[model samples]
Target chain A: MKDLDGLDLPTFEDVIAAHARIAPHIRRTPVLVSEALNALTGAELFFKCENFQEAGAFKVRGACNAVFGLDDEQAKLGVATHSSGNHALSLSYAAGRRGIPCTVVMPRTAPQAKKDAVIGYGGRIVECEPSTSSREATFARVQEETGAEFVHPYNDPRVIAGQGTCSRELAEQVEGLDAVIAPIGGGGMISGCCLTLSTIAPHIKIYAAEPEQADDAYRSFKAGHIIADDAPDTIADGLKVPLKDRTWHFVSNHVTDILTCSEQEIIDAMKLTFKRLRVVMEPSCAPPLAAILKNPEVFRGKRVGVIITGGNVDLDRLPWIKG
Target chain B: MKDLDGLDLPTFEDVIAAHARIAPHIRRTPVLVSEALNALTGAELFFKCENFQEAGAFKVRGACNAVFGLDDEQAKLGVATHSSGNHALSLSYAAGRRGIPCTVVMPRTAPQAKKDAVIGYGGRIVECEPSTSSREATFARVQEETGAEFVHPYNDPRVIAGQGTCSRELAEQVEGLDAVIAPIGGGGMISGCCLTLSTIAPHIKIYAAEPEQADDAYRSFKAGHIIADDAPDTIADGLKVPLKDRTWHFVSNHVTDILTCSEQEIIDAMKLTFKRLRVVMEPSCAPPLAAILKNPEVFRGKRVGVIITGGNVDLDRLPWIKG
Candidate 1:
């Protein structure tokens, strides 16, 4: 609940430190420049293809940093977290690499691909009903039973620092970006991107693209208060989280704007990404592209960076019309 | 039908030259190493991801090389070819870049995605019934009508020279690969690979994988005579071609073996590739993985190179499961 001001805010140095610490454990996923996309949007776009990252998402950076940054005793106790999909897979992969035990509390509705990925990486899963209350109760039970350290998916400072490593690499890879747009789920990735951009390239603007159906963060950003949605319905299951107090502070201070895209637009962009870029991206990952495609005038002729957050779409339930 | 023995084969120098010619026009797709795959298959696997190559296939290498290799007068006439899918898209993309006219004779059964890609890149499509006889007849009519130069998808020397550039880049990327395995359709890619390896590293064994249902190339290699299957049925639609005379000669002289995998094994391998590698591969592209999984003892402890040739899978009619 502490405000992310003088004492709580992460400096550029902290993000740089996080980058160095997680460098060995995480991959520097390639930044692909799409001529097709740029020509369509009229914006010179650079896609930071984090979908190609280990565990098929950017969560590995933060998860690896959080688990490895722990003290020896804390590391011995191992780490526990709750996630819909990407975070669990990343935490499981990172923890597995360090030979530490990991337990992930996931919604039973989470995609089978993600659950398989988490299990494949040797993580124990505790499934709960698809509700926030159920998730919290299950997490509490698991934490008490194992006496493990909880690495909050987005709210914790360590996770934020780890996530910031993505933007650090982006800033190092491409210079003079006018802005960076990242899809927001629990605010972990965007918070990290903001922190890194603020330190490394303070002039570069950072934006968050939220699904219209799950626009809690966008509403909260405009209202200057934390917003919680009772039951959001959107294809981007990843971006269904309500804003947390810690994430609200970071999001309010660091992010330039929180934009919303329609579910249909997200689906169209997802299809374009798969067909043209030949990369599998879930609906949440398409928000940045959606924003650029819908509001080309706002981003035209500017050097825009977009993060393809993940590629864990279920083949059977693909949102786009196939063949 | 001219004997390839008297006709000079492309040397590694020729491949290297072709690479320089196409380098500016093509992408150097990533070479991904999978520790998990290596552990599962007992082989050090280096996957040259040509699925991520320009136009979503390695066919672009040959298409670009042939297009650019043409004399000014010949190029003025433009080019024409017949393909099931990937080759049409590649040729369209290459021709579009060169500002030249291109005519593609595609089977009516080809996936809509492939047709869209070809059209999107400004190629004129001439649909033919799904058979070798119909395709050849349609292509001949188009060639005669347009007075366009013919670029045979597999049989042309220029096209083979272009495809060789993939192995040239692969050899440079991964050092000391003991062998290279690629799926054999018309034997264009394998012929090119063989031509490159024979001149650069003659000791590096080359293997061709063919689906058991469409094992004409495999039988041809064993019998010391070019074999043709009048009717072949397999999940690997890309490997349905009967070997061409030129390619058969190269396979007989240079390739160490032509391995066969079951349709079920190919589907399983395709699913594994998507799950573990986060890459969408068609059944033909998964043949090397099937070979490694089915015959682990053959590749155990050896540095094996697998060319993921293309990723033009039809999501609607996925070879593995009906959606």
Candidate 2:
């Protein structure tokens, strides 16, 4: 099945196929439930701990699917992306495992640690200006020169199908979830959740959690169209990207609600999660708990599945522990 | 089985009974392994994650056993302990769950966060001096006045039996571990490991790790007697206590070796574990990794089980983040 945007939207079958293809590469992250967190939120919360996934995020699932699904000819050309975070690292990780080249077009201002991570995973870096136009232009040039297939961080069908495996596994691991919540950046993970749940467990409501400081997805949902943002500064750095065509399809078609929480609320939720759950995650992943805390009425008695999207964090730069 | 001190040392049968008795009260924490950490150490390290235990430590197992194992009349008097860390919080947690009054005699200099945790868990705090003499004196007065049962942190047989359940679970979780290493504080966890492994998996080596700043366990192990220290200081605050008689018997008889690591080495190992495992563990839990890293030859090519003792830390005071 293809969306109206002419992109091939992978079905539940495709997600199943992706899971089988990438099962050997990606991690089957455990579902951790904390009685303390459940008591605090007044909800039965099941945390899908993708923070323990390879490359430290669920993106590795999609990256592995895309890399491993490629035919020999296409695989020889390799994979490329414009992400500066976990996606880039994951793609690099996947491509390295397959013995193929991976190129990352990152802004020159990207953190040195992230750059080193990409390099550590055998990724070639193509530095661009700190702007979307510059990033796209550089990515185009790199793809053209290297003949590398461009994998949009969230918009590709294979990537979406790969991410959908998380929810499929969640359904098998946990029974009778009233709703599922995942952070919406470019809407990849939430889209994957929607794709999986809408087909396998259609009774389950799908919710999108977004940082209020970078509320592009929230605003887009209300406006009934896509709202593209260039460079919004938020502590949830992974969530600054705007919704693209493929993700907008899932959000518009299946999502029940889009919730937003303030930056302070997200940080508080992150700390509370660490204290209660004993798991370290990036700020972008805390928006689900933030939304739950802010609008408890929406989720008060529900058995909610929260996808902890990632755990890549700078230990020296905790938001609460200020310099 | 009773020891020379007339303490009825709980046998492997008692550990099995304790597991059945305390199963409902405590969490069966998951065993997590990090391939990154394994690669770094050149050993297959299975981390028995007690940090995720209720009340945020493995001490909850013993605390729950002691609190719940009591008969009705004895339970009416409640429980009391003289400690300033995980033991206090865990005992308070257990007591709170069982609807019993618990008293803790803590040093006046203990961190406010730890004190708050005990109070939050419904424990009454009696402030004492920093020395063991002052602590014991204050605890004696409190126990005499309240008629509460004195559940000595590591000296009691029930406590050792309670902790022994961790190694029992580890033995079931992972097969063919060449050795097991746990941080030695007052030697509760190590003694428990010794008690369990020495009985069932007698071939497996038992190693006790200690911080160099608080090397009473190391010194005592070599001296062939209990060497009580008065308020040793280390970043691993949970391990500052000295060895007691009940723990000394197990350590002197069953332990294969006692290893020590410097303060900075412990902090570095803690940071590395956080980075690689994405689990927030306390400094007291890092000595095993420090020992592994400092002496790779001792652990390389072997399958080792490292017990993560706790995760209760003052997040505001992370060592890597300079003030």
**Looking at model 2 chain B, which ten-residue stretch has the lowest summed lDDT?**
B1-10
Docking class of 1: acceptable
TM-score of chain A of each: 0.94, 0.98
Which sections of candidate 1 miss by over 4 Å? A1-7, A107-116, A126-138, A141-145, A321-323, B1-4, B107-113, B127-138
Which candidate has the highest lDDT of all? 2
RMSD of each: 2.9, 1.5
In model 1, what is chain B's TM-score?
A: 0.95
Candidate 2: TM-score of chain A is 0.98
Question: i-RMS, every candidate?
Answer: 3.1, 0.9
Least accurate 10 contiguous residues by lDDT in model 1 chain A: A1-10
Error of 2 at A121 (Å): 1.8
Query: Candidate 1: deviation at residue B175, Å?
Result: 2.9
Candidate 1 clash pair list? none
